[model samples]
Target: MIRRLTALAAAGVLGLSGASATASAAGGPPLFTDGHGLTVVSRPAWVDGNERTFVFTVRTAQVPAYSVMEGQVSGEHTIMVTLPEGYDRVATRYPVQYHLHGHPDRPNTVVNQRMFEETTVGVPLITVAPNGSGRGWYTNWRYPPAALGPQNWENFHLDQVIPFVDANLRTIARRDGRAVSGHSMGGFGAFHYAEHRPDLFAYVGSFSGGLDLLSQEQRAAVIASTQLPGSGTPTVPVESVFGPPIWPLDGGWNRESPAQHVGPLRGMGVAMYTGNGGDLTVDPLQAVVENRAWATNIVTRDHLVAAGIPHTFVDYGDGSGWAEGCTGKHAQPSCLIADMDHFVDLLMGTLTHP
Candidate 1:
């Protein structure tokens, strides 16, 4: 039978374990909670058998409320966590791996945790996967202010979610204690977070991610993501998150692309994976997507080399990831699992995962 715990943060009260020092022993106080005003209102509910869950509150509500007086639930976000096996049985702190999901997605316990937990079986680490918003782009919106509700995903993840996790959980609570990884768009998010705040993470990995946000093809691809198939409806209303994807304003694009900012990743462990025109699972077009990702990653890999930042780059060509029952090489499970297997190994080598 499944067990349920009492609501820790009951009735809007911040119910965190004030005595985690006892549980974590040598592990220091929570890093992101003291100063950060985040509240944990409930206990975790893992939809999947492996991963646990946590629903916390953010100070600023990025998305507006549907009904004015009702308030916004987006302010109260969900971050599903996968604790080390025997977490309840042991009293120790562990390193955290923040896994980001792709576009048109939410923080899913099953979809995200399955690959991570399966690959890291017996490994002592925590996997925290937060709701990054469908088509959130994982960046602050740069244009179309009126139509889209306040879109500030970067601030939500960096300023709020990261700290909140550090606050409530028995984490290592430092740069060396944390790592970030993502698939497809989340892949972009992982690198973006690592590149922007190199101090917060010790390792970064991207599986079939869009590292070059400045590429014209990538820019157009994002535009296409906003619309639905067949119906042509505006699914996500992503106007322009990277500032006009064209000339004039487009010049500003280089300011943030992970490929252009390799210096920040100097000492950090970096790993990336993608298929080279591999299995076009759904259709031939899927191959095009992987092909595009491969192109962007090559330039990014070269940038890392130029900056003397050592990284593992795998362009597992055609018939690589798909043969394992996955749809194909682009943004399916097989590729992400492969990425995690290699990345977790790299992370274990650097992080204090005992």
Candidate 2:
């Protein structure tokens, strides 16, 4: 049965509604007002035979946030949470793994579903995927101007979504019991969260993430890929994301780029994977872009190594050339599935139970 609650009631439970006596003492700005609160837009349903999934709509003060179509923010956003195989059967709480979707993909996608199904075969971890609204890039916006309110992606996920999940689910709910991973843009987000908020996740993984955002080449690629074809308008601009990308000088750019913030990952278990862009099926132009991203991952891996941070790097060999490695291109379901399985195995082995 679907369980629905009034916005006020949900806010009270989340400590965001004015009705909550604990609201003032919560130590942070409330995400919702008395009239705004999270709601279970859908009931829990089983998928792939075992996984239980729920859909939720969360109210955020950060509206007018960037949308995929450019220059827009969605106030009420949805997130999908999937429980472990035996969630209902067992009374024990399980560790949580937050999976982020790549650019242009929402929280719920066939790729994410397939990856989750294949990766959690023997592991028991609850997975959550919050929508990034297309071009949010999983980072708090700097261009559209914050004066519009806190349309920050980082705040939404770390502050509101995590709290909502913990309040409603049987989760371990701590750094030691949590991990984060993502593909492409999501990979960047996973690293960003882990670096910026090391207290939140014990493990982090990036698959084909554009880790080196400060590099001119990377910035160019970002602009190219995000541009609206034929119109030549950039959907996500460097100025909007992290100021001017003036490498070595742009404090904002350096602050958010994973390559520049490798210090925080010193003790965290990290995993990174990328393909050689050898798949003939993929467009040649896209292949170049993917290869460049893979190169960026390589640089990030080197930084981690130099920082004495232990991490796992998987180079799924080139598709066009000869190399011994996993087969799949960027966004290829097979490669993504394999990478998630490998990373989840690593996470499951290290994560502690409550």
Candidate 3:
């Protein structure tokens, strides 16, 4: 039978015990009434006779209702949390891992928690995946006025999501307690965000990421619509993603290039974990020896090395990530499930230890 307990009721349970539960004893707090009438409820359900059921919800709306209304402001955002089985929150103040999903992966990627919870079960932590950036790159693009629709994902996260998580949850929102990580485009965004705002994050992780596009033909290809020769083939949808390419603008492309911001990152005292899936190949060019994306990565890495940035780089190939150039069969990797699990496991370890 599944058990459901309300905030006040759960608090009564804890108060009755008098002694902090196992989880609470370990720096993890129990889901109880926050004295201010706010309720944190944890539900335990049995599925298929295995201990896979761990879900929690915060009644933020019942608290103060800080407005999920967009437009550069912060306050109360409801977050759904999944707790580890046998969790005793009163014990420990666990570390938090902010997970960002790839395109169309928001909300869904929360399922990836199984891999993480499997390892850090006893530690008690928070994993948040807020809505709004399903297709947005989490960057503040100045081109096209509203490059990614009417929504301003970058501002929304910085202003709204972060605060909600910090205020409502028993979290150590400081740099040392928070870690940021993502895959693919999310990986790109994670690194970019850390570079721009290193103070918010203690650790950063990128999986199968496309590091940079400045030096490689990938940039040209991305801007192919803008730079098409003779104008025969229709331009690619580059404008859709980054508005019109601003090659002529002095700081336009540089703003989008993670490679350009390596210097600041090196001095930020931030921890970073990055890995590439050998399965992904770079976008192939007609005459180029390697794919454009791969080329761009090399340029980015060279820049990082030159700047002496310290970071962990992992290369795990199952043939589904951004490989530069490969015409052979199964050119891209497909071990998404396994690779993702491995990468997250590695990230947890890095953040916890480093």
Candidate 4:
């Protein structure tokens, strides 16, 4: 079942006011109760030939609560929602597919929408891509040491984003009608959410995901790269997300790592894709990172198999590439699109309409 944080628990963590607490207890819409607000920042505009896009700025109620404790200020976040062609003419509700982006990458709704539109063709679905606020890792923070500003991404996505999409659009609104997928860090988030909140999604896909966070060597490499002097915005400290790398035994790491939570994914439709980091089209540094991620994905896949969880494993290794001219390298647009196409096909074949 989708394990929702109880209103009481959520209110306590967010420090909701008396009135807000009551509203939460009364089970009001998740975002409406705590002054967590949603504003349409942009009008529904036509984009990428036939799709319609709407952008909403989400002011999180939970972040302010965290800020009060940490004495830091938090800001509103934005998400883009895309509707399929003929959406205005159709009276039918559609399945919702949430596509999550990697760290240092903002939501790419237009590219995702175009990919979906071109690949799926007649498949009607609403595509939602929410910003991960850089390096939140889509996990709830193990507070005090971790910055409270971005660490509450799990709440923002589950309690805020999902509810907002359901309220504003025509959606399937249930587990079978919903799917989640992402790339790199987002791939980890997709599996994390599926394992943690299995009741919220029937299918989950991860593309070039960092599935195993407990590896010491990989952790060290990630930390080194992220802390490079001239890196751009959203440069994150590894300690802020998962604490010290003495992970594996660390509760924080175990809680978020998909490899640690494979039991929950039993019976769920899971799809994972990883490139072998051998493509000449990608940067050599990125190729090395992709190979590391591929190793992590392999370990995660093995765990799932050991747990008897059946899944689709797309290993676009160094030699075996896609027929569509994409190879096994991290962050290849063509490879990601091809993986998404297969994911959508799986969703179409497996999910039953309510």
> Lowest-scoring 10 consecutive residues by lDDT in candidate 2?
1-10
Per-candidate TM equals 0.81, 0.79, 0.60, 0.79
Candidate 2: misplaced stretches above 4 Å? 1-51, 63-65, 68-73, 145-149, 229-238, 247-249, 279-282, 319-326
Candidate 4 structure lDDT: 0.66
Per-residue CA lDDT of model 3 for 1-354, tens digit only, reads: 112222323222223222222222133333333323334443222222333333333332221222122221222223334444443325333346665655434332334545344544444456665432334466654442222233345555655556555554455556655677665556666777777778877667665445575664445543542334322122224554455555564355567677667676664333322322222343322213223333444555677778888665544332324232322111122223343344445444433221
lDDT of each: 0.68, 0.68, 0.45, 0.66
| Model 4 lDDT per residue over 166-255, tens place | 665656667877899999888988998898898898899999998886776556654653464332233455566566667354667756
Worst 10 residues of 1 by lDDT: 63-72
Off by over 4 Å in 3: 1-81, 84-91, 109-111, 143-150, 215-241, 267-296, 319-354
lDDT of 1 by residue, 1-354 (tens): 111223223232232355333333232222233334344443344454443333333344554311111122534555667777776666566789998988656565455667767776778788888766556667777663454466677777788777766666767777887999998888888999998899999999998888897788877777776554321223544455666566676754667688888889999999988887655555677778888988889889999988888999877777444347444457666767767877788887887555
Candidate 2 is scored at a TM of 0.79
190 Cα displacement, candidate 4 (Å):
0.3
Candidate RMSDs in order: 7.9, 8.8, 10.7, 9.2
Judged by TM-score, which candidate is best?
A: 1
Task: Give residue 61's lDDT in candidate 2 (0 to 100).
Answer: 59
Candidate 1 Cα misplacement greater than 4 A, ranges: 1-43, 48-60, 63-76, 229-239, 279-282, 319-323, 326-328
Residue 324 C-alpha lDDT in model 3: 28
- Residue by residue across 115-163, what tens digits does model 2's lDDT show? 7765675467888998776656778766654433545788778876776
